[model samples]
Target: MRVLVLTKPFGALPPGELAEQLAQAGADGADLLVRDGQTVTPDTSWRIAETAKALRGNGLELRQVSTDLISADSESERVIGHCAEAGVSQVRVGFYRYDAELDYAAGLDRARRGLASLAELAARHGVRLVLALHHGTLHPSAAHASLLLDGREDVLVHPDPGNQAKEGGEHWRLTLDVLGGLDRVGCVGVKNAVWEPDGAPGSWNCRWQPLADGGVVPWATILPGLQELGYTGPFSLHVHYPADDPLAAVRRDLGYLRGLRSGPFQSEPFQSEPFRSEPGTAPPAR
Candidate 1:
């Protein structure tokens, strides 16, 4: 599977430098989350285009342009147009506002309409739209997000395992069940979050730690399950850890994920009808 690292984690570096750093960290590509300083909107499309181009020049393709601003048809169209100009293949839509409140069902309705509109535009432009299951939103869980898809073949889901862990292992497992039967899941976000130490109450510190750090979500289990579910997509690493050397942490995690193996029982059998001989007939006359 391909691995795409988030470009925001290297926000301190210039776009060119960030691309190089991501390459060194073993990312096959990068997910561009465009944030314009104090605001989150599609207004920075030009900057996003420049960044996408830089990454492409450095041999790292922009797998998806993730944004929290595609809740309306106009916004979605604008973003898609910009992505097309930048030569991006997909767009990841986040369906929530910044204050962390569910933007009413009316907003979700608008988002559904927007997604459909965006999907059509994307197809016309040769791009795809993927909805990511973000934490603390209307579609916070995989099941909830699946309900939104409503059998639309064009849309895809980007599952973030670490966010599911925050919701609880039970929720995470439920998410897997919801997504287990799908055929269009395009990508997975591999992020690690560690529970705070003893003194910290009701708080969790999130960071991009190595797969072995025990702080990030358990990838060994999740990876095999994902493979079993036929989601052979990129494992994008999102590093939110605060450290002096984030690249080192990403490298270690990449190594750990690369070393993971699918065990004997990790995969499930493919479902199909049993083969049968001709009804009421003897063996074939050879």
Candidate 2:
């Protein structure tokens, strides 16, 4: 598995600095975030290629991107086109939240239409869009996300076990089963969240923590299952937690992840990726 750091909290760092910090933490690459304040936002999308070059200079790859790309409009196309230019393969699409004013079916349809349109645009640009399971969105769980993904192989899903530990906890095996049996899963989200009681009566909330911290998600078990199922993809470790030294925390969690990854498939050669090559890039040497 390619261990990647989800570059959210370190968005304040420029691409070169972020890539160097992640490389120092022993991360394989960046799950590059494309947001308003980040290095590679919609307004600064032109930096994608240069950012990718900086990562490669540090022996890292820009394999995936996280973005708020929900429509097939010019803005979405613009970001994706630059991603293709930079050789990034996967783009995390935006969330579709549930609302009391909106019907669930209608909401689901809206999500699918947006995803389908986005997938078409991504395909045109040689990129694949992925959706992540969050705690409160329509994709709170892998099974629910599968409902949106049914009959659609053009898009993929990434299951965040930490988010599920907060609300939609299920067996890891069950999650892989629900997410189209691993074939349709593009990657996994690496983070941990634990519940803490509020001062008020019957009030509790979940907060983020590093993987080695006090969280209930058993990556020890899940990583093995993923390898057994022949799922080889990025584990996008999140660094959005409030930490005094987030890079140190990342180093610790990355060590934990590397230790858990010593399962059956760890030593095997990387399998050929089915994802089409980016435009203007040469194919991988066979």
Candidate 3:
């Protein structure tokens, strides 16, 4: 399992500086999130390639890219082509949100159609398209993600447990059961946060914390399950905590995640069968 730094959490820095930061954090790769005020964006193919080269030169891989969803066939092909050129195996497409004025069922259908088109274009470039399960989106739940990503090897799901915690706060054990059962979870995103008891009537607030500090991610439990399932995807860490030193926070989280992955149960023998949804089955501790 390769650990990656999700670039979005670091705000925006030049590609060279970002590469240096990733190296210092001991990350094996980077999840390119081209955002505003960042060194790179989807607009220029050359910048993407240059950034990828810089990371590679520093002995890091560009595992995935997060960018806006392209509905136009030509644009989809173009974006994916650039990603392939930059040695990115996968590219993340934007989400389909539920609009108040739009019918729910109609919105889902629209998303399905749009994703299908994007997947086709990605396949042509020999790249996989990643769709993350984010809050307020049409496919926020694992069940919904399954519907959107079913039967398409060219497309995969990026599961963000922290984001899920915000929207539904479902049990990590149950989420593992649902998502691990599917073969499409190509990457996992990590962040930690807990809900605070706000004084407002019937309302709770979010308090972002360092990984393994206060959030309900259940890394100790989830890591072993992923290992038992023979997962080899990248684990991208999202730095969402408020810190006087964000870089220090990122380094600390990276160390914590690496330790958790190589914990006692990691040496256990894995089952060859697909992940079972059986309750109370602790991930193999062999």
**lDDT of each structure?**
0.69, 0.83, 0.77
For model 2, which pairs clash?
none
lDDT of 3: 0.77
RMSD of each: 11.5, 12.9, 7.2
Candidate 1, which segments miss by more than 4 Å at Cα?
37-41, 73-75, 97-110, 170-177, 180-182, 196-210, 228-230, 261-286
Best by lDDT: 2
TM-score of every model versus the real structure = 0.76, 0.88, 0.85
Candidate 3: residue 17 Cα off by (Å)? 1.4
Cα deviation of 120 in candidate 1 (Å)?
A: 4.0
Q: What lDDT, from 0 to 1, does candidate 2 have?
A: 0.83
Q: Write candidate 3's Cα lDDT for 1-286 as tens digits.
A: 6998888766667778888888888899888886565667656645778888889889998998887774546656666788888878889898788687988878777888898888877877788888887877876777777676665656778888788777756554455577655466778888887888899899898767799574766677677777777787788888867767767888999898888866766332333565665787866656
> Candidate 1: deviation at residue 157, Å?
0.4
TM-score for candidate 1: 0.76
| Candidate with the larger TM-score of 1 and 3 | 3
